[model samples]
Target chain A: MAVFVDLNISHTVDKKRLQNIIETAAHLGYSTVAINHVVDLQQKKQEIGKPKCVSELFDQFPIVQGKSRPIKVLNRLTLVVSEASHFRPTNEFKSYDVVAVFPKTEKLFHAACMSFDVDIICIAVTEKQPFYFKRPPVNGAIDRGVFFEISYVPAIKDSTMRRYTISNSLSLMETCKGKNVIVSSGAEKPLELRGPYDIANLGLLFGLSEGDAKAAVSTNCRAVLLHGETRKTALGIIHTMKKIEPTAERREEEEAPVLKRARTEAV
Target chain B: MVRFKSRYLLCELCVSDQSSLQLLDDRAVFTGVRGAVCRAHGDYGAALCSVSFAVKYLNADTGVVFLRCRKSHYRILWSALPFITHLENRGQKVPCAFNCLYVGGTIRTCQKFLIRYNIQQLHRMLPHCHNEAERLEVRRAVLNCSLKSLEKEEEEDE
Candidate 1:
């Protein structure tokens, strides 16, 4: 079975340890690695002295280009899902075999599907609690090892993604496992995450069939790294070329006034 | 859980007994994730253009809980939906990257000449799309939207 290990390469990661994991995943016969990041805009916000997003983070990663590295970074987008910049990372990295994302980009991902050239590897969060370890990998703290364990804030429901999902593709369905859309333990310590089968079973319980469930772990990921897919059922989208449809004028009239009143109240 | 926007208004869509949503018959709840509160008055169509249909349920203690599309990262899955439906309804064959047209649950053997098959490397598949209209449209949308957004930011700074 051809397996693609899902890995995220961040500047803050311990360079030596990260290299070891990449080699470990590679030695295990993985075909490619789906690279993603949170690409925290917290710094961007701090820099601009207000909330601001730079276009550079979305730029295609140059480090992954040289083939000498055992891992090939298929997906480039960070995991954060804001409305505007969410799709930019995917678009910039569309040349890769797979794209990575969380729930936040759902609307834009769908709206801009066709513009991409890869399959989506949705990151399913396995742990229930919301934990973020700022450690060895993440520069924010050079901290690591399952940063979050407990939270004053409630853990988001299984289906509820921290950021709204954009593109719910076969690849993403497999990698993320299910409710928790992430792979990084947010730590420096090596965490023994539930392997592919374990992850796929979670998806099965959450409404995916055995085939789709398996694809989320095995084939969807392989297809992404191997650079294409075969099954006729698989889907792809062109971002701009949309088939426009006529609107229901009747519905428009009815919803019109209630919204208008609400707007007046909001302002 | 059902979440309803009681006071807000929406264009009432014709609802069938088997429609995806049942609570608000003929009504699609329009919610803005952006917290742009005044958005409703200016644009009703775009306001309701959410990833999934969310209706307000009067009974919830919390405010409206949106249904996020947490399925496969369907590349432009939302955008191509109308097109796919239209093409299928019209009995048009949507092109697949492997050269053969795919639709109606089977691949047409009539090979499209543009793509070549490499049995040794199935990963390097050619574009399934036979046309460029969608590509150009996406490029334009990104450039236009990004520009407009950038301009809006600049104006606010001044």
Candidate 2:
């Protein structure tokens, strides 16, 4: 039940806006916040270049020719997020409470290179595009170190809740899962996203077995969201998430398990 | 991949004619785009690709025939198979499923893919035809052969 604040859509990525949102999210005691990229995937990568310092140069222009996983731009954002986590902020943000996302799937794959080991979040589409990079930012990514996942819906609009669609996507999900992949919302904005139980319910309505639905939402999504980045980068993650803090004790009632109502495969 | 729960007929008149004549087994694989979407290529929104397709019959003058495809892939398939143009003509004796693609059991996008960029697996399938009548017959034959063989295999396994 993580609440992702959409940084991808906001007009500003400047310090003021970022800090303000972080403080709000932290004070709200949300366990995690996805730094969503609002624009089209490619543009977001170009905004951030290759990582600086030491042995590796991710900005291999020749290597990252295509817009999707251009070497340098992809690597740069990994460093940026890693560095940004250490950015000096207001007392609340400095508490190291939020994890950032480049919001670009291509950059995410590259960021997961040797420099960083994070999952690339993708959106599910009828069409397929190359989301994995050849030379990842890290070494073990291809063989189960780095993870990836896509946000999916039963149908976007006017589409029927067909089993083939689910089966096909599920097949793809299964295939990717074999490669250390995770499933995600790839949600454009918050309103478009459903919580864990909501996603699980969607699975049930779409012909998935109860086990599959539970795995898709509860296990699959939680595993992706509660990643190492979510764990290591944030200073007060467990402290804020745990009932240990006096300020967060008020969330006890809200922590009730989500309602088990079934969600239709399509809206 | 995309799929539709509803079954679509390639040709209503041809379907009734064929089955009654014992030319068809009432067994068929109708191909068409389901839950289709059309959009511009990128943020620039420069051009548009209308993603639509369905199964169809081709070279109407000669005989009965059908084919499956996606509208977005029409250009590629048309270029690959010369007879595709003849099928595109409205007055031709055969029509085609230009609006969709059928692969295996479910209707799907004709576009192919692998697990990732670096992998070497193909994810989609498409039909090839030269004329309307030829195309329809080919589509029918493909479905019939595949279904009959599958049934035989199932019977054998049982």
Candidate 3:
């Protein structure tokens, strides 16, 4: 089974609340969750600092229901860009596992979708989508393996926000044809978080087909994680560190068992 | 006999306070679901939903609800079930959401599944009882329910 993942839990100042949210996520069968720290550069002098260590969130990580493994927590940084200069890729961007961009204008939206090397382009949930999702940029993002994210927490919190969330996601789905889209809960509290299956069903209301809706919770999120991994290496290869020596004896011994079994079967 | 095609949804209304469940009934649930579908899926969904949607059974005590809809449009209604945050009743609002447990082709199958699902839930709750008294009480309840259900099944079989 594809392990369910909720890749956008909103980072909160209250440690206890954040811990409760993560525990609820684990109980809801999320195998992995990303704590998103948002930076709105529209505010003056907003410095993007390194994300806090995810390990400090809990003493022992809560085990995912039905999976019997501790939920994997990851750090993410989201930059809300209103203007062109709002987003700058500093070394701080490399500290997090996933980077997301919420563009506030048509220019920034196009830029974030096409040229920006972020993993996710966050669609507006709290308000109406400011600019229309033009075909070229959205298609370019998909071609570049970047995912468009729609957060559901806002919908849970308010009815007006629910209208925006459903409309915005439908617009994105219209142009993207439900490809390379991820639905995540930007839940600041435990109550805002819904189960993965619930979100998958909610995706249908967002204009996604049944299979694509399920993928929004599982496979597409995995693709986004892999996209983040590739950003760290050169073409996903060519590491700067020296290579370690392999044990030739161990390699031969590992090969010998399979070979001996094959020879015995042949005899 | 020609039978009309229909779908039955077995759902559980999750509420923080059990007292709030009393406020939920067939009409309130119907209104909540209709409003949610209209808001989320729009007028077209609302029109499609009013076709044959009905609340067949509702157990306020256990929070179980059986919603019946046309087979062709059950998916649309199923998608809207999660959006129901609360049901308004008698000038008061109760915070709750519906978690769909099973969708069956017939009410008979849904009832069968609900019994099995309730038993599984009871088994899960047994370990969480706080003290010896609570544990024993839960055990007796479980045994009583199983015996009653088994006897009912035997009567039906005969």
Candidate 4:
């Protein structure tokens, strides 16, 4: 089975509350979760900062239900880019495991879909989607393996947001044709987090087919994680590992093989 | 004659407080499910679920509920279950979530699945028993369940 992943748990300053959310996520059977730190460049003096180390949050991570393994937590950075000049690739971006962009304008959305080096592009759920999802940009995103994300927390919070969330996602689904779409909870509280199967069911409400709905929470999220990893590496295909040096015992073995051959020839 | 088919959904209501389970009844759960279906799928879903939809059983102590709906519209109810954030009983809102355990075509099948599920849960809790008494209690519970089911099967056979 593809492991379920929730890629957008809203970051909070309260350590205890954050831990509580992660615990709830593990209980709900999410195998992996990403703590999201959002930076909106529309504000003045906005600068990207280094994300905190994920290991420092919990001494012993809560085990995911039914998986018998401790949940994997990762740091994610979401850049709310309203302008082309707002987003700058910096070393700070490398510290996080995943990068996402929330574009506020049509031009920025097009750019993000076509060429932005980010794993996810968040669809607006709080307010009405000001611009329609054009087929070309959405198709470009699908072809490039850049997943469009729809967060359902707002929908659970209020009816108005629910309408917006459903409508916006439905429109996106029309253009993307249910491919390269991921559904995650932008949950701030533990109650906001829904189960993976529940989210998959909710995906059907958002206009995804049955199989695509399940993938939006599982396999599609995995693809997003792999995409994020590729952002850090050289095209995600080539990886480098540290080489281990030969020990003294290995050197003696090599010498013993040569010595044995010489002795056998002499005999 | 072709009989109408229905789907029985077995769900567990998870709450932050154990006492809140008592606040839930069949009526509350029924309305909660209906309202969630209305909210999620709108008028069409509400109309579809309104027919042959009922809460068959509710166990407050175990927080288990059995909901029956027409097989054609069961997906509407199943999909809307996760949206039920709370149930209002006596003008007080008790926060809860419904975790679907199983969905079966018949009530008897749902009952069988629930019994097996409870036994599995008991076995999982067996290791956590601190004393012999607790272990014995769990074993007794498991045995009593199987004995009851066996009696039911024999009675049906007769």
Which one is best on TM-score?
4
lDDT measured at residue B34 in model 2 versus the true structure, 0 to 100: 21
Give the number of the best model, judged by DockQ: 4
Q: Which tens-of-lDDT digit does each residue in A64-180 have in candidate 3?
A: 765658899998889988889767778688788999998899998899988998999999999888889999999999999999999887887777988899899999999999999
Model 2, runs deviating above 4 Å: A1-35, A38-116, A121-126, A130-145, A158-168, A177-181, A188-191, A204-212, A225-267, B1-158
Q: What is the lDDT of residue A144 in candidate 3?
A: 92
Indicate the TM-score of model 2: 0.29
Docking class of 2: incorrect
Per-residue CA lDDT of model 2 for A164-248, tens digit only, reads 3345455544444334433334333222333333344444433455566555543544455445334333321332234777877
Candidate scoring better on TM-score of 2 and 4: 4
Residue A60 deviation, candidate 3, in Å? 4.4
State how far residue A203 of model 1 sits from its true place (Å).
3.8
Model 3, which residues run further than 4 Å from truth?
A156-160, A232-267, B41-44, B59-62, B111-141, B150-158
lDDT of 3 by residue, B1-158 (tens): 98879998888776767888987788988888889888767899888977888888888899889888899898888877766777898889997767676789987788788878766666545655789999888778756754576557745743
**Cα error of candidate 2 at position B148, Å:** 62
Q: How far out, in Å, is residue A216 in model 1?
A: 1.8
Across B1-158, the per-residue lDDT of candidate 4 in tens digits comes to 99999998988887777898898889998888999999888899899998999998899998999998999988888888877788998898998877777789987788788878766665544656799998888778756765666667745732
Candidate ordering by lDDT (highest first)? 4, 3, 2, 1
Instruction: Report lDDT (Cα) of residue B75, candidate 2.
Output: 28
Best-performing candidate as measured by lDDT: 4
Question: Candidate 4 DockQ category?
Answer: acceptable
Q: lDDT score of model 4? A: 0.86
RMSD of 4: 8.7
Ranking by TM-score: 4, 3, 1, 2
> What stretches of model 4 exceed 4 Å from their correct place?
A238-267, B115-158
How much does candidate 3 score in TM-score? 0.79
